[model samples]
Target: MRLLAWWSRRMLSAALTLLLISLLIFAASRLMPGGFAEVVLGPFASAEEKAEVSAKYGLDRGILTQYWLWLSSAVHGDFGLSMITREPVTTEFGLRLPVTAELTILGMAAAIVFGVPLGVLTAIRAGRRGGGALGRLASGFGVSVPEFVLGSLVVFLFSRYALGLTVGGYVPFGTDPAANLRAMVLPAAVLSVFVIAVTARTTRDAVLTVLVEPYIAAAVARGESPGSIVRRHVLRNASIPVITVLGTVTAYLLGGAVIVEYLFNLPGIGSYVVQAVGRRDYAVVQAGVLLAAVVFVVMTTLTDAVAGVLDPRFGRSA
Candidate 1:
């Protein structure tokens, strides 16, 4: 019952947060110079044509009324048509979502696989001669570099050295699995770097804290193997903070994916949003950002739910 109540509250909070985000997106879109009619019909277009376009898109209505109308239609899954392309925003979103989804999944998977182990090793070796200094240095470097710079460098190194890897151009996975993976690899690697650093550092800190606990010493004194003790006692306790950080990493990945996609010319939603913003395609921009926000909120909420499940006390307290 407690868990159920907690989940209910979380969902309600997420909905309210999304509503606020939608309002902000709508307001910003409205504030941009020129309306959809002006952009669509062009400066050479007659005033009559522009007015017709405005009325067609509800652009002629007051800002609040327009926002309310958009919001109402959005709740029913209608994001309206793109001003530039005249295609439904939802259709483009559906088509482009898979590309970004694949990139995000690959980046996240790499981060977890590499980051957790690095954190564990670094934490264990803290204060020793070798002492995880290399790991720490690598994490620092990863976090310090911007994704675009890192991506450009990767492309240069790959091309300069004749590494023979495909650095750009996307292939749909459904059409060619091998080529698709090759195209995605570089971008995904770039996307993973910051997240990997964040996860490793968070894990190291959490594990270090857990190591100092009395139960860890108790486990050690009880004739447990070193590996067994760490596996059973240390990681479980440290996981909550790590999980929480990873949840936030989802947002980072979405934001970073935009740059990464642009650099690599991938047809992902991130790139789509970038293009929409550049062209001032209000419908596309609004829908794309809203979708990203939804994904972020859902991931975070799920992360909290998982944390609560792992530690029942979390449900009670939260």
Candidate 2:
């Protein structure tokens, strides 16, 4: 019941945050510099035409009433029409979400495959081996390099040297799974870098801290093998921070992927959102923002819940 209460409280908090973010996005989209009047008018429209178009879209409605209606529509998954495409926003988003999810999940998987082991190694020999500097340098590289630069370099190498590899496009997995994964590999690798670095650094630090605890010392003195020490003592204690940093990275990964998707033309949410922004597609923008916001809240909730399960002593742990 206590755990359930904690989960409920956190969820409520996330729900409130999500609501505020949605409202902000909706209001801001309407107030964008040229205004809804211009958007409704679209490109090459005259001032009089703009006014007529705005009236047709009901831009004259009061913001509060508009907000309520949009909110209601959002509840029903009616994300309005794309200013640019004239297609339903939900349809566009539905097509894009899975692509982004695939990219994000693969990136996280790469991070885990590399980071957990590196962190464990560094933590096992903190001061004794002094390899933290190497891990730190790796983290610095990951944190400093934006995805675009890495993405371009990746594209260049793959397109130039790789045999039978296509470049600069998206093929849906449902259409051709093999071709889709092939196309996805480069961008996903780029997206994973920052996340992997973060996980490594956090894991190393967390593990080192846990290993130094007196109980860990006692366990070592009792002749616990290094593997056993890590499995039974270090990991158990460090799981909280590991979960935290991983969660933070995961939250940002999809948003960060915009650069890679744009450069690579991946048909993912990142690409969709950027195009929406460029075209001033309000429904697309609104849907993208809401989706991103909801993703953040949900991931935050997942991380907290997972961490509590992994390391129940987290909140009270010193």
Candidate 3:
């Protein structure tokens, strides 16, 4: 019963937050200089044409009325026609979302696959010898380098040296899965850097903290093997904090997707949003922003739920 109530509250809060985000997106879109019709039709388009376009899209309506109409349509998954391409916003998002999703998933997977083990090693080494220079240095490098700069360097070295890397442009998975994965590799690597650093550092710190707990010392005194202790005790306790950091890093990576996609010339939602914003394509802009917000919220909520499951104390408090 308590869990149900908590979930209901979280859902209600997420809905309210999304409502606020949608309103802000709508306002910002309307507030952009020169208006949507001017941007879509160009400066030289005659007044009659502009008026017709505005009326066709109901842009001439008052702000509140237009927002109501948009909100209603959006509730039904109809984001309306893009002023620039005359394409449905949902269709455009549908086409681009998968590319972005693939990139994000691969990047996150790489981060976890590499970061957790490195973190565990570092923590173990630190506890044993009081130093972990290599792990510290790697984390420092990951934290210091921005994704764009890292991507640029990778592209220069690989493309100039003829390293057999596809540095830019995306290949669809259906066309050739191997080529598609190869194309995404560099971008995903660049995206994973920060995630790796954050997850490693968080995991290292959490593990170090767990190592000092009396239970750990008791386990050691009990003559348990190091591997058994880590598997049964250390990792489980340490994972809560690591999961929290992963959630935060995942959110950061989604925001960074824009830069990575642009640098790699991937036709993902991030790139599509950039183009739509430049053209003041209201429908696309609103849909893209809303979609991104929804994803972020869902990811965060899931992370919390996972953490709560791992530690029931967290669930009770939540």
Q: Judging by TM-score against the true structure, name the best candidate.
A: 1
lDDT string for model 1 (242-278, tens) is 9998888876566438888888888888888878876
Query: What shift in Å separates residue 258 of candidate 1 from its native position after superposition?
Result: 0.5
Clash count in backbone of candidate 2: 0
lDDT of each: 0.86, 0.79, 0.86
Worst 10 residues of 3 by lDDT: 247-256
Q: What is the lDDT of residue 151 in candidate 3?
A: 85
Better of 1 and 2 by lDDT: 1
Tens-place lDDT per residue, model 2, 1-318, is 777677677878987898899889988887777765565556678888877766776667788987888889998889888766678888887878888888888988988899877777766656776656676777779878987788888888877896566666678889999898888887788888878888888888898788779998899899989889888888878888888777777877765378877878878887788777766777788888888777777877788778777767642231
Go through the candidates in order and give the clash count of each: 0, 0, 0
TM-scores for all candidates: the values are 0.94, 0.91, 0.93
Instruction: Write candidate 3's Cα lDDT for 121-228 as tens digits.
Output: 998899456578799789889989998899888888988897777888689999999899889988888888878888888888999999999999999999999999
